[model samples]
Target: MKNSIAFSRRSLLALTAGVLLTGCEQNTFVPPPPRVVEVAHPVQKTFTRYLETTGNLAPINTVDLVARVQGFLQSINYKDGAFVKQGASLFTIEPQTYELQLEQARAAEAGGQATLKQAQLDFQRQATLVQKDDVAQSTLDVSTATRDNAQASRRQAELNAKIAEINYGYTNVAAPFDGIVSNHLVSVGELVGVGSPTQLATIVALDPIYVNFNVNEQDVLRIRDVMRRRGMTADDLNQVPVEVGLQTDIGYPHKGKLDYVSPSLNQSTGTLAARGVFSNPDHALLPGFYVRVRVPFDKQDALLVPDVALGSDQAGRYVLVVNNDNLVEQRKVAAGPREGDLRVIESGLSPDDRVITAGLLRAIPGQKVDPQLRKIDVSE
Candidate 1:
């Protein structure tokens, strides 16, 4: 009876230990819930197709102000970097000397006029006397020759006077156009235009500025194809609108039109040179600035997603999408130009796919995710 009781106690103890181990295993091995992520359908809308490029700002006109006549620099009419109007006098180069030369020229012109009048009277008299046979042919010929010489001298004097007047006008240098003038290179009282033309200053037009860019051969062909389909003439090409923005700008705030397009592509760079003109009344855009440029081609319906949702790796750009089974999968995408805060997906994503826009780190590939549906803000 003692042996039976001992055997029953050991059996009960082993059964109690097994029950405890089963309970612990059931509680400890419970799997965690799926990671939660925000998912959204790519925004569908009519999007403008743009050929995006980087370009440089340039002045529409840049001219060097130089002394055309020899004289001392008498005055600098504009301050350094001052905006001036067209035909405004900007410099005076020894006006006193030029003024005296102009006076001498005028006197010479007056003398020439008097001599020409006398020659005309003498020629008339000589011709009348010869017609009446009152003077010998030789005498008339001598008078005619004298009158001709006087006429030639008068013509020479008139030309010299005109040249002198032109030189006098050059003493006062004027702005060729409305532009901002650079600092004077030569100081006051310095002799200029002695040997070669002296550079006085530089003026750059700022209102209508140029943005220069290059389009690859492929893009050029694409643009031409669109033009051909639309039956657009060369003149219509200039009417195409262009938009630009500075590097720090959020978007293209400046508007312009296509000013020029090269007729031929560059053999070495495989690019076509193009330029646009923008009206910058505030003088905000400056020359030599690297800016973002875009030309709208046409509008079409396209799928767009938040730019922040896109990710990249060695394989290129991609986005994460949750499958119908709530499993995360990476979709490689071909991205187009950015519109506002969204990026145009050229391909590789279906309209019905649920793209993970948030909790990207937790949503691993091939793992289940509890996706929370969200809507993309197209207004931005």
Candidate 2:
């Protein structure tokens, strides 16, 4: 019985020792987290000097065709959406009424002319009679007055005929300028009246189109500096080079020039209105199309860091950078204007330093990490 008790104690002690050792081994086996490092190699990229703004494309010219006279729509000469030229026939009002009015006026004018011719003969005869004392002065005077009355009547008739002719010309509705027409609003034989109150259609000029954009006050200052550096005056702005861009289904494809800059800034919006002109021989740029503007400026090289590596703290903005010893560090950085995916590093970092790009959520300041150093291409 004594030997059995001793053996049981030994077995319990051995099991207790094994448990303690296992706990110790586990305590030493803590896993390390992944680390990301920023690369410092010079990269080649076209840092486009650009300004982002919302803008809309507009036709160089837009006009609404409205009725000017009372008449039935005799014909719609131009099809809806058809390209039209200046003075092109668009609508024909029933001109039969106007034509008849014109004929009546012409007849009256002819009658007045005949009367004037007879009065002139009578005046000549009266003048001869008065000069030769062949007739009484009072009779000659009466004849002269009659001749003047006839002349006045002839002038009135001529003025009436011209008014009728103008009304008759209004029957043929012609385009004021070259442009594409919109849908027809009225059908043939519809009672369209003077001041064809309803628009026949809308026409927009597409070639050398205008792209309207607004410039912020700050950008205006920058542009002014640029202009001064180029020795440009107000008169020079009309000829200044302007570049325009638009994003299409196939990507940003269309190109144009900056042709117009508004003389005054929009007070309500606090922006300067500007325009860009582009060729639309194919009529691709329709008025009211949405597009982006790309305004290029002088190229500059600046210190930058990827946006992913940056973080905000109570002390402002900072980055987790892996210093020379490959250890995690908290760097308080001053950031400046953003350049695409990277931001200009105003201070607290150098071109030779590497900043941590990822693994930030898993990291804390002063923590030791198993660094998976991936080289970042800062040039992109």
Candidate 3:
């Protein structure tokens, strides 16, 4: 009877231990709630189709100032890197030698004129003497020949005088156009325009600047077709609008127009060189600057999403999307050019798809998420 009582006690103790372990296991097991993420739906918007390219800025006009006459550079009239007006005196070569030559030419011309007058008078007298039978016909012929020779000599002398005057004027170097002048190449009292024309300075027009860029053959064809479809011709090239941005700019802030298009494509590069002109009244843009250029071809409706929501991996660019069941799913997307802060989705996404735009780290594919519907900001 004592042994049976002990066995009952042991069984009760074992049952109590088993119950306590089951309670502990139940207390430790806790299922986590769904992760919270901000979501937005893709929106349809009108997007302009732009052909993006990189280009270089150039001046509308550039000239290297050179001395046309041989002489010493006497003075630099303008300061270096200063803006100069058209016909402004920029430099002066030694004019004393040219001036003396001009004076000598004038003196020779005066002497020739005096000789011509005397010969004319002699010829008249010879004619009269011959008519009176006081002089020989040969004598009249000699006087007439002498008068003609004097007239020819006078004309030659006059031409020489004019040439000397022109050479004297060349001593003063003037700006060909209104532009910014570079530093002088020659200092004062330096001999210039000796054997060859000597460079004095450089000037570049900066008001209207040129942006040169190359377009691929495919893009060239596409743009041409677009122009045709829009009832535009080759003459309308200058009317086609373009936009540009410097490397420091966030977007295209400068507006311009296409001014030149190559008639033929470059065979080696399979590209066509094109140029656009932009007004730079403030002289903000400088030549040789790298810039971004865009030419709009057409406009159409496009699906766009915020760039923040897009991520990339080895598989390509993707966006996390929330399904109707509130489960996160990875959606591969083909992205196009960025417009403001939003990116155009070329493919792989639907307008109704809810994209997770915030708390991306907390969201995982095939996991439940508490998606809070939010609107995408499209303000630029």
What lDDT score belongs to each candidate, Candidate 1 first? Answer: 0.92, 0.77, 0.94
RMSD of each predicted structure = 3.1, 6.4, 4.2
Which residue pairs overlap in candidate 2's backbone? 43-379, 67-196, 69-194, 70-194, 242-258
**Structural similarity to truth (TM-score) of each candidate:** 0.87, 0.68, 0.82
Which scores better on lDDT, 1 or 3? 3
- Ranking by TM-score, best first? 1, 3, 2
Which consecutive 10 residues in model 2 have the weakest lDDT in total?
37-46
For residues 240-359, what per-residue lDDT tens digits would candidate 1 score against the true structure? 999999978888999999999999999999999999999999999999999999999777899999998999999999999999999999999999888878999999998898999989
Judging by TM-score against the true structure, name the best candidate: 1
**How well is each residue in 1-380 modelled by candidate 2, as lDDT tens digits?**
99999999999999999999999998896665444433342223445456667688888888888777788899999888999888999999889999999999999999999999998899899889889999999988888898999999999999999999998988888888888889988889888865537677788888878888899999998888877887778776655445544565442466766677888888898999887788889987777888877666445556666777788878999987666666678889898666657876667886666667766776667766556556555543
Among all windows of ten consecutive residues in candidate 3, which has the lowest summed lDDT? 220-229
lDDT of 2 at 309: 78
Question: What TM-score should be assigned to candidate 1?
Answer: 0.87
lDDT score of model 3?
Answer: 0.94
Flag regions of model 3 displaced more than 4 Å. Answer: 1-31, 103-155
